[model samples]
Target: MIRSHSKLATALMGGLAAGLLLTACGGSAEPSSTTAASSAASTAAEVATSAAAEPITLRFIWWGNDTRNALTQQVIDLYKTTHPNITIETETADFATYWQKLSTQVAGGDAPDIIQMDEKYLAEYASQGALLDLESIGLDTSDWAEGTVDAGRFDGTLYAATFGVNAPVFLANTSVFEKAGVEIPDDTTWTWESFAEMAKQIQAAGGGEYYGVENLIGVDGASKIWLRQQGAQQFTSDGIGFTAADIQPWFEYWKQLMDEGGTAPATATIENQTTAVDQAFLGTNRVAIGFQWSNQVNAVQNASGQDILILRPPTQTGNAADGHLWYKSSMYLSAGAKTKYPEAVKEFIEFLINDPDCGAILGTERGVPTNLKVREAVAPQLDAANTKVIEFMDSIADELGTGGSVPLPGGGQSETIQRRATDAVLLGDLDPATAAEQFVTELKAEMGLS
Candidate 1:
């Protein structure tokens, strides 16, 4: 939500490399007279020199692509202007590789001073003592988004800080609706049955393309929605939420849709050539509806040259609890448990979330700005697409169900249940009921739950 007139530059990748080299030489090498006095009371600051000195250097690292890396550097530069004595070292990479490097650093006692973490890994990292307790570092969470902060906590102690919220939204091509002679329904009250039925209707009234919607069994997000509808969580406090019986009904639901020709064939999901943003089948007029996060609607619409409207997921109850999408931190910033300058690292995180310039430069790249103050500051500068997302989320704020607990402690295999559902069905190893039962058992076992 923080919108800055100045664009953020992505220089952290290079800066981080330099920081690592300096770290190799050891932080104790020599304190430049410029290094400020450490006023931070945390243990990490205990080793510093006189309080009259300038702020010391704090090394931070995170995973992100070109845009994210650039914006992060811009924010850091802005922070440096005000707190001139403090220096921040940053690193970045794509999501998958980012974790690999972070895990290694954690094991080697050289983890970055600050890390950009994800919910899927939050519990695991926090449990392993790889991260610092955020409260110990002087972070104030009184103003961050509720869900964002909650996502970063482990065992009731806040360990990280978050910056935004994301929700699943249905991207629709209004032009396709007109051509197919179909009317968009009041999504608030529409049920999954209604959505499936409507897709059939659109296919019957076909104009150009496969049908009214294209969803895939292989899509993890979609599977999450179905899992929620069945009154199960993705992962439980102990581990997997449901047994194989629970998975069966959901698999059968999708299988029925696929069998009825209401969605694109399985081959399409596996073989489609499309960029993450373009969504080729939906953008090129081959499908009318696509499931994506609200943050992605703009890119999808831009590629298609169509009027895109975000709609609520279809659910049975008018009460709406059955179809709510919980908000999450776009990413979290946590300190390495082994860092030599924990206070500096904590200060760097504080500046990133609370500084006006940092928030503005961040804009919506992290999803909606998690800071209430930042959201207000950046609202005026938002583009139409971004503004729409803000307004939509505000409208549904009260309607969202409980954000729920953080994901369980399974590392790489946390999402396995969703992935294996179809395979279990296709291989004839078990029926839907049996598959669901086995899924629950495996998930619990992986989570270390009895």
Candidate 2:
């Protein structure tokens, strides 16, 4: 998915040693009238102090860059101030290595108390009995938008709580278009054909300085949209939902873009595959348009130093109704099923999801807040880039189609497989049809459907 608080010093414990010693030594002696009241009060105060709960330590882990890590630490510090009894230890890693580390941790029976989850792997972990059911732990989801609460649900149980909602978006660098003397296409009326044509024109106008668009054949997000627009899904409750025939056209479209010089060359696109967001073709100003999650607009804009515009991905029919766009959880907050501090983890999650302070600090780093109240509270404070993202999502709120299906077990492997197949086709190692067929076969086998 899109993928800091101050540290409070430990509070000094009240002195109870003297009070206990006095109680033990003063056995049969009654205090004088003048000292009786003071003595009793002191004794009671010490008893209360001794009875106070000790601090509970919680471990939270997530995948993100230094920016996200710093912001999250601030939130943790803020939470600690109010919840002095809870201490949270955080671990962070980049997206590429996160799952590998987490899997190792889980295998060693030492998963973090709080886990930052993605839709792709939520089911994988949940089904394996690694995640706690939020509902069972008393999480409040009443304020979340419709279907958002359910995004982290599997088999009718809530395993994770959505951190925020996002949708696939066309992040257009408007400055690039203007420089190329090309007009931005109207998203509402644009089709796949028009999209390609616009890309070709932009490339032509740029005099080879920039490609028209980033190559998206390897992106699972783009593939999902393509499948959804065909009235199918990448996965269903049963198995692979779309046939090889359905995916061939998607591959064919990218081939056409490459042939027309509308997208980066195979090698450039492959190189872009492993590039960071800040170093990608779009971020580095090598393309006029690129596809990304809605929440990533700010980062791309900051990286490119351009007037980034958020547009709906083009539909097959050039109509909003035909577009397969829908709101999805950018990520989720899940508690470990085996956590020793479930209540503490639950409270932390609740704060992260519903607290305005958390929302303000987090902003759209994850995505727009899933909590309606938090979303509204942070609206006025958003930067220009985030404001555009909010506006874009609002403009298409009613037009979104049904949300995507829950990815099945082993579904996390689909993206890598798709990327490999896309690379093969773009490199002429496989035709679109052959790549599509191989993709389906590999995906079905990975998901244990065959």
| Global Cα lDDT for candidate 2 | 0.84
Model 2: CA > 4 A from native = 1-51
lDDT for each residue of candidate 1 in 338-444, tens digit (9 for 90 to 100): 77777677667777787666777777767788778888888898877788888877767776655346677773464555456555554345566766666666666
Give candidate 1's error at residue 353 in angstroms.
1.6
What CA RMSD would candidate 1 show?
14.5
Error of 2 at 404 (Å): 3.1
The window of 10 residues in a row where model 1 has the poorest summed lDDT is 33-42
Candidate with maximal TM-score: 2
Model 2 weakest 10-residue run by lDDT:
1-10
RMSD of each: 14.5, 18.2
